[model samples]
Target: MAFWTYMLKCADGHFYVGHSDNLEARIAAHQSGTIGGYTHSRRPLELVWCETFGSREEALAAERQIKGWSRAKKRALIAGDWDLISELARCRSRG
Candidate 1:
């Protein structure tokens, strides 16, 4: 199965990270308000970023890793700021 790591831009100008084997269906569910909880309170989320992984383990690992990033970092990611992303990842590796 194909797994994806996804990012959502919430109403509060924050980002959410999640992984799923069915990216399209999961996004649809979230949009429909069926995927309740933290995101439910911040509906109308926009899919800003996503990456495919060959395995669920990799997708989940990336999700966990992204979850710890700062807002600016996440924004950089969504904006496809490859330079910033690379720099941040490098710094993370050294720390």
Candidate 2:
């Protein structure tokens, strides 16, 4: 089964990162607010980005890494700006 690392743009204009084996169902749950957590209260959320991985471990690792990123970096990722992402990473490391 394919696992996915997904990013959601919450109603409050914040990003939420999570991993799920059943991306569609998990997204539905979030949309309905039945997931009962952060995204739940955030209400109306948009699946801004998602990427499939070979294993749950990989997906989870990606989710965790993204969750730690600054908002600018996450925006860079969602925008598919690899150059900006790389520059952000370098700046973060140098700080």
Top-TM-score candidate index: 2
How much does candidate 2 score in TM-score? Answer: 0.98
After superposing candidate 2 on the true structure, give the runs of residues whose Cα lies further than 4 Å from its correct spot. none
Q: Give the C-alpha lDDT of model 1.
A: 0.90
C-alpha lDDT (0 to 100) for residue 69 of candidate 2: 97
Residue lDDT tens for model 2, 1-95: 99999999999999999999999999999999888989989979999999999999999999999999999999999999999999999999999
For lDDT, the strongest prediction is: 2
lDDT of 2: 0.96
lDDT of 2 at 14: 92
lDDT tens digits by residue: candidate 1, 71-90: 77898888999899889878
**Clash tally, candidates in order:** 0, 0
The TM-scores of all predictions, comma-separated, are 0.87, 0.98
TM-score of 1: 0.87
